[model samples]
Target: MGAPESLSLLNPARHAGGVFVNGEWQRPRGGSRVVTEPATGLELAASAVANAEDMREAIAQAHAAQRAWAATNPRERAAVLLRAAEGLQAHFDELALAIARETGGILAKGQHEVREAIVICQIAAGLPLQAQGQVLPATPGRLSIARRVPHGVIGVISPFNFPLILGIRSVAPALALGNAVVLKPDTRTPVTGGAIMAEIFQRAGLPSGLLQMLPGDAEAGEALVTDSRVPMIAFTGSPAVGRRIGELAGRHLKKVSLELGGANNLVILDDADLDAAASAAAFGAWFHQGQICMASNRVLVHEKIADALKARLVAKAGYLPVGDGASGQVALGPMIDNKQLQRFNALVHETVAQGATLEAGGSHTGLCYQPTVLSGVKPGMRSFDDEPFGPLVNLVTFSTDDEAVALANNSQGGLSAAVISHDVGRALALGERLNAGMVHINDQTVNDECTNPFGGPGLGGNGSAVGGPADIDEYTRWQWLTVKAALPAFPF
Candidate 1:
């Protein structure tokens, strides 16, 4: 693929990677990280690798903004979000291209993420209209009601994959409900994770200091989570890091929302349509090069249909081309960086060494590992027991329906599961038994929409209000209010 004909350099200031605090770009005090394009390993830009001192300054600014923004009219706040969506759409090209370059996603995938973000903004704009609390029956001459209130500043730590979508998914709702935010985009994809929003909202009339974009590494993340002024935190990343954040949250007793890792499973029964099952596997296992946390990590097929399903999946996967996402026609893109590329390769080698047959693509060049499929894999191997965030899928054979459900629930991180069968009732029934937050009947595991209950159970997520419109309350607190027509008789 050639450089996108429509793509051009972003504003020099944005590419320079200044942190946005108090509504303006903050130059690096000294240290910085050179962000390189993952697919090609070419220098894209230098982003500030902010330290604790820088983070403290950003947090202080966010607290001040939260207080001021809380006083603004909710209706006005909603209007700003709508306009921000407009801003995102208007600048779609630059934002999409940057996502492809930094994150190693194909152009189509980048465009898809941007679309989800636009809808998130549009939907979140209506959140203010729901702020009216329900009145409750009270003692005579008194009224009682519960009202949602913002929790000052929210510390948002986002990941590299789907940077824009995940970043805005948490950001839009927080802002809509009057909370200030200090966002720490992944060091791997600072521009899409931080700068894009900074630019979009700067033009969309959001007050200065309300949204701070800090492009930094784990050190900065530590600073954000420990900062008492922020009061609350939302994080989407690996479970190991999530646990560390959890420890800090407990230490401070701050509110936290965690969307963590998954070792998702896809199950196919003997009565299932092999064609549909194969197609679902290809889409769910290889999309984004299998970087999604909810990716189809393993396929469990009933022994009666395992061979046929394997053949169909290999054929379907062969038809899908692989290359740089900037080529505009790519499906599977490169791993985010060489480290991820190496980790992906290591998992594949380990799986085969554990007696699993290398049944499909396994060769690689640079960061582009082909979509892979393995058969006869079982428990104990990292490929079988752990989540590998790359385009690799392992096959396992199951006997009874009970066995299938048991295999699907084998992982500690059960985020999503899919059951495919001809009998809808059987599929639905199996779906109910799977240990996942989301189960897809007659489909695959990788699907997600803007308006669903998106988090999983166990270490998969903390379930602090995300996924649906009901999540508007995740970034908010509740307060009870009461009034009396006249002073009620005081009871001492």
Candidate 2:
């Protein structure tokens, strides 16, 4: 297909009027907020900043809509999601362009994200039937079955990176399971998220208020989560924010799923292919400017291959084309905003001050930070301990499998890890010992499959996304149903 026509930039106030609530497009009572493109600092769109009243109204609508939707059979709900997926695919190009422009992701990457969103929607559509529970043996003349049920109104707060895909992935599963959703897209890239979801739901004939999109900042998100009407919350963002949300949800005794930040690690074994490993590491470290929650931030190479891997990894980083995300050939995009850029720069400088050598690409152009590699990195450096959340990777060398495994496990954040090794036995053994939620053998650890569970343990945070069946299961609660024959008249 040819490139999709770009969306005409609209004034933030005017765009904010499009926020969907109660089956109608309307503006927030508190007014609107402007969204700017990270790459050019151009105003991309404006979104309605929802207030306390808006949150209440949305919650009420969701509660009412969720009851009706939950009453609808799973088969019908599945059909709606399937239809939504089809609609998304039909308009992939349009959706992709909006995402690229709004989120500062390369056009190709945006297109891929759009496609992935469709896939997630399609997979989630099948969740209705797949959510079937088991029939357990019971007493004589009694039948007991455990079934999964939705958590009424669910609140979803998505991050700026992978806005389209992650939002859809979370929302689709919740909607498919017969729960109403209140989505708060990231303040920086709300246009693409709100637009794509509005388009798909409009086509799917979804009930009014079943899926509401409120695009704004932290205040808006706080309003949604703390509101008593919302029974469940799904958040993907920084750990600090996730912790706050968790604390709030805990007070209410509400259910919450959080996919927080990561300082993901990658181990390069002595037997690995230096060229391929370097290339994969570069991509894994720099994709989406390393804004991804699961982006590999630390590299542990066997001393035998450390020098060769570092040389090739640095060289590969230099080849990454960085520029306007709208440019099709650009592989690296700018950070989401100036704040993120500054934070990234600070981490790099701090790591260097701590004795880490800058291997390549530490310069910045506006929100764009060059794909950077730092060697001789030791523990205690900011980049080594904290998630850079930018295009930065720290490299260190290990002497043995035990030491490498120890180093990998040293981080409090155990989100995900990649081990590049030719020896399958050793890889498997290491995988078993590693404490991450997922491990990739001979590959970078950014692999996200719709059917596989995604999320990390410990400080990486607890919660999973898009693990096909696991996602469906996570969004629902189980109830046991027992049917028993009447007692004998004598007993009565």
Candidate 3:
């Protein structure tokens, strides 16, 4: 079985069954919450819940630590991040299991998430050494310089889907850039998203109060956004929640990076390899149960090849396995919970009733939704308009390249899009026309690399990106300084 046989991987001593703040575990005044494994409906662990007071303490600790952390040698900060990457690698199995057990992602997906988290940490380790400023042109006997400095306390809010990756993508970079961080992971996957990061960083020699893990509810999140101590907020979740955070943060005059979800797309041109495109469609639409923000929301295909692609996708969906992730015997696991399951069912059923054809896979058993395939999905349909955060392969036909681009751009989201065609130049041309943050040619929509700036426009994100050089801009403030031999005398 791919499932972890026991909870042996979790060390109670390390996590302390409490929220991590000031580099130590403290029982949250909000009491404890029993985390349940989404795939099995089994008790995973009892995690501490941070209240408004706890959030205040976490932010205070972050503020206190940031001064010291920002003053440390860049090399020292780099060392901590590098060691944290090593720590993540060392505890890969434990983290992977926690991800699978808590989030309903299969073991393989958990492993992939851990690997991505490690890579991001390694990338961030080098950020401390990157160029932090520039020397500007100066008049004779004067020097002008521009420098980047850390935002004192950064509040990071991460989601349950791909928790480790999302959490660390912001946390590692913020800390590496000499900022202390207060991270609030989604309450559903606290261990993998919050406490586990604390454990790894603490072992990696991160200074006390530098990283605070406060896994709590919406109240805590609201408090973090509104708190003056948190000068910046990096959030990853749905567009609705992102908008609220943005509104709240804006009121506080805080800088915010909103990495929100989207109704992403996978476009298949008539000239594409049908087999490859079909496979990509299936993978993009169903991977991680389609909970990914970049998961293909709509498959826009040339009407000429739409029938063939739909047939292939329908056949693939019929046999794609669905069961408990802990068993490790399935291709797709259960939805995060019954609410998500019901939402998926309602969306699919409503779309089908609205003249869309449910060609394959519309049934469910408990929380395990079948890999669903729908055709004849038009722009106004619920399946086309709504973000399909489930295994629903929606096929929308377009007659021409212009029509495809028009159809793809007819959404509020602009996160990720994929264009598949044998002609590289043609695919690139079409991709350029798509109003998406990231476009893939001859590939699927879901892609991430630490070296690449990742974010999209419109409802998906706020046009600000993260990763690579983007982190330098995202986590720091630029200051311009000029100096002369003495203070220049003004006319008196």
Candidate 4:
């Protein structure tokens, strides 16, 4: 017989009890909210809705625990992250199932995100040695050294798109830097996030209050970002909310890192391989139901190949399957909610009315909008200017390399862009001219290594999120130490 009902992964009992704070699982001050699967509309779990008071209490706990955590040696901090990574790997299947059900991500995609989280934790564990400062030598018998230090306590506000990955990406580095953390996950997907992270940290032996999960609405988020006890803020969400958080952090003179939304562009040069370009564009546009911040929103193809490219793109988009997230054969799933589906449909209707042609897929069912492709789109249209954070791609034609580059840089957002061309020199030149923080040559801008500094410019965010040594360096600050060998005379 199949596994017993109690032994099945879908049973809610396998999930964590509720949000965790001060090393304990507890309910919110008031009512609760149910977390549901987007694709099937099934209730996955329920979590307490933390409010302002809960946020304040959690911050106080974090502030109290931060002192001792900061005092702990870097080696010990790294050990905690390492242990967390081990625990995450050990419980990978359970975490993946939770993510799949909660986010409606396809089974394979959900599993991949969980693996990525494990890698992020492992990388974070190395921050103890990686965060070491520089040694400067000025003269003999004199020593000057710069050391990276934690920012006391940090507040992290994560979005729902890649709940676990985004949370770990920011929280891991913060914890590794020895700063206590107060994490406020988006209300919609808090169950998976709370369950996965709390278990890992607990298994890693993290000190009480060093890390806490607070799940609630905008009020809770506001409390965390504005709290005086939290010295730093790391946020991932829309530009509107990011601006508000930045303003608050600015008022308090606190450090802040925000990874906001994007209306990213992908340029297809005349010389690009049609087959490869078509494939990459399809993957970049529809991956994760186009919920990714780096998803290619606009495709600027050279006029010479625009028609051919459009045909191929339409064919590819038409074939994407939409079904329950648990199905192995499912490639694309539903949007997070009905509101997003309506917004996407309205954008398509508006774009078509403005003269853009619907090249493929525009059907909808509940929360799922079919993978859509539109052509003859221009800057004046909403699809060209706004971020269609659903599975939609707008195709626009350009005449020359310069025009392609110009069109790609026209948007106020500059998170990421890709240039697909076989010519090395041309691709490099275009890469230099694009206004995005990241420009990929002959490749899609979807994959990012944790070591790379990842963030965007213009409307994207103020600082980088992941990439290079400099990327991870944003997680810390610096302090200088000086010593005098001889006593100096004091004068009043």
Candidate 5:
């Protein structure tokens, strides 16, 4: 289904071109791509793809705008973010519908994403008021200070899943910290990811050129990463793509933050409540059809209770509704596209062929795949070793707590992990050793808060943090200032 008329800017004719740069929407130099609804295979909009030249212009415009923006007082910048948060809240329903229509997420999921984004906006609105520097001890008759400063222009490359949250989390904070942003959302969900932000900020009375939205493919993304004018880049996507961006940005000597892929695990200990653990696994593993980076790719259960938990997961998986989520009739929606569906199928089939038993759902009509479960999964299987962004959960049994930790930390990713146990102390202790960025005890892996530092090491992120005070380091640099009443006498 198409987006509501309130989101008409997604229409190519209304946008008048695909890119939003400098203060207005304009045509890009690159070719066009059709944005389709994965749930229905219907054309949602035709977005103008931005080529390298278009990206260059956007970066230059952002650089030009950033100087003046950074010169503004902290309160002024914070006020704009506060207003943007209100604007986002005002259009909550429309934004939620656009997310559902553009990304095939269920309406509830869309609403949740919008609400999270609004919270992020609200949190970011207060960033400017935070201490931006420190007083340094100096010699007598001298004053010294170190102040945080903006990085000028920041380039953000966001993925399709949870686009609004990912995009806003970076954009709002960057702008609040007095930096201009050039956002290149994944072309698949540009309306909800890019255009909506532009409309919200513009209505919130943001100055022109502070935020540029260019929805495009790899060529444009590379242009943003390699451009000399854009000194920092924030990317959220697959490990493969994040690596590419990291390498390129490193070569350019630019600061980059990456929130990449994960093979997150939900470890169910022997003493865990089977019903609660099973419900958590189902939601963590299959939410958003498992497209999320934090989605539980593997469910590791204690061998003592593996069979019981598996049965509950099988029963739950069998009953979850799967269909077009845009119709508001399903808990799980279609895969982002057929290409992703093919990949999910290949991984699941290969894992099953490797001797894992198909315990529950394992079929699909169109892009809506069943929430398949695999039992007897081993480390060598694709389902356990690879990051399959689909509705499939690999069930592996661990003999001891140490074995559970080893299995959970087996993957290259260190993004998120969850531990379920009746004993809170044991769960917390186990979680601390799991090598993940964020750990939830007695909860699922998929969790986020505006104030939480949201990133991991290794394949997950590149030593940079996001959210709350982390923005102070990610979006700005430091400048030292010293003054003396008179020139100190030197040997002459």
Candidate 6:
């Protein structure tokens, strides 16, 4: 049996309901939005929605708190992050269940996200210790040095897909660099993702007002972004919105980081192992219903093995279980909402009309779209350039390696690409020609590590890196200093 659709049907108080401001929960000034269980259309909770006033208060609180937070010892701040990781592990089951309910995520996926979230916390904890600086080599009777410092208040706007992981990754890194965060999580799953982080940080003994979680729709995000108090923004969503943010933040000469979705692709060379390639495709194309920004929009296969790869993918997609996430028995779960499901179906229909043949599931029963595979996909098709961001994936064949690389690079840069080949030399050489911020060899496109420099070129948003020890550079500002004991002759 699956879990009930509504938290009201269970222990209502357990839902971490309300907006988090100044290290505390507050009633929304603009009312609340119903958070529905996508798998069943059941009301999970009424997440508090923030209005302009609420957003202002949160930003003000964050700005005020940032000073104290920056003044605190970096090592002590790191200690808090490490403790928060342990606390997250202790509440792992509860967090996983909340993630499944909030996002309609399959149990295994919810568990996987929680595990990734914890790892992000752990990595963030160690980052503060690795902050680096350099001393200048050329100077007489003087000292010259450069060091990184916090960017003060930062506004983090995260999307619904993998909310817990995405939300925390942004928040943890900013905090590690001694900055305060005013986070606006996707309204759909705020409590499970945003509010939960506030809870853990509070329990971890983080200072009050250091981090605020505001749960609301796009209006709230806009208010947070356009505000002058927030000098920086870290956004993860579509390129359209990222452009708007870039324009606004640029107007103010403010710093911003974006991780927008892209039309990603992968290539399968003829010599690759059939079963291994097939498994990689299934995982990359269908995990979390293919909502990842790095999910494959199209796959280029060597013509020699195209037929075999297509058959394997069809068998895998056709055999995969699909149902409500709470059942813990299905491999695939529901789309976030009906609109995405509609788009998924429309894209498939249009692609088929454009001459691609459907080899597996393409329709839907409510929000649960059957994993779909389409062959003979061409560049001009709606499905070719459009990133459906669902379980639907396309297969296109290439006769030569140059053609495959061309197809992969054909997109207007945003995400990543993968090259699967038995020849390491060939794979590495081909990877060099791909246009992306990240590339994988003999691997899938849908991949991330907590300590990697993740983000891409094109419309994927630039000017920041949100992962690894390198994150200190993005979340903080750098200053060069020079000191002289006495006046020296001017060379100017």
Candidate 6: clashing pairs of residues: none
Worst 10 residues of 3 by lDDT: 1-10
Error of 1 at 56 (Å): 0.8
TM-score for each of the candidates? 0.95, 0.94, 0.97, 0.94, 0.97, 0.94
Residue 364, candidate 6: C-alpha displacement in angstroms = 0.7
Candidate 5 lDDT tens digits, 1-492: 233567543345656347899879887889678888888888888776899999999998898889999989888888888888777777777778889978889999988888888888888888889988999999888999999989889999999999999999999999999999999998888888898888888878899999999999999999999999999999999888999999999999999999986678899999998888899999999999999888998899999999999889888887889988877888899888889899999999999999999998778999889999999999989989888899988999999899999988897866899999999999999999987888899999999878989998786777567997688888899999999998989999
Choose 2 or 6, whichever is better by lDDT.
6
Tell me which of candidates 1 and 4 scores higher on TM-score: 1
Candidate 4: tens digits of C-alpha lDDT, residues 388-412: 8888878999998888877887888
RMSD values for the candidates in order, in angstroms, are 2.5, 2.4, 2.1, 2.6, 2.1, 3.2
**Per-residue lDDT of model 3, residues 1-492, tens digit only:** 132435343576556458898988888898878777777788887777788999998899889889989999999999998898877777778777778888898889999988888889898989889889999998999999999999899999999888899999999999999999999998788888887788888888999999999888888899999999999999999888999999999999999999886678798999989998999999999999999999998999999998999889989998989987756788898888888889889999999999999999888988888999999999889989989799989999999989998999898866899999988998899899888888999899989878888999887899889988799999999999988999988999
Q: Candidate 6, residues 66-171: lDDT per residue as tens digits?
A: 9988888879999999988877777777778778877877987788877888898888888778745788875678899887878899999888888988889889
User: For residue 174, what is the lDDT in candidate 5?
Assistant: 94
> In candidate 2, how many Å is residue 236 off?
0.6
Candidate 2 has an lDDT of 0.81
Off by over 4 Å in 1: 1-9, 485-492
lDDT of 2 by residue, 1-492 (tens): 433344323234444546778887787776777788777888777766777677778888888888889989888888888888777777777667777888888898788887888788888888887736789988778899998888888999988898887788889988988889999887677677675686577668788889888876767788888888888898888888988989988898888888886668888889998888888888788888998887888888899989898888777777878988877868888888888888899999989999999999889888878899999988888888888888877898899999988888887766788898889889888878888888888889677867778777766776454457577667888889988777546754
lDDT value for candidate 4? 0.81
Backbone clash pairs for candidate 3 read none
Consecutive 10-residue window with the lowest summed lDDT within model 4: 1-10
- Please report the TM-score between candidate 4 and the true structure: 0.94
What is residue 405's positional error in candidate 5, in angstroms? 1.0
What clash pairs does model 1 have? 106-325
Q: Model 6: residues >4 Å from true position, as ranges?
A: 1-17, 485-492
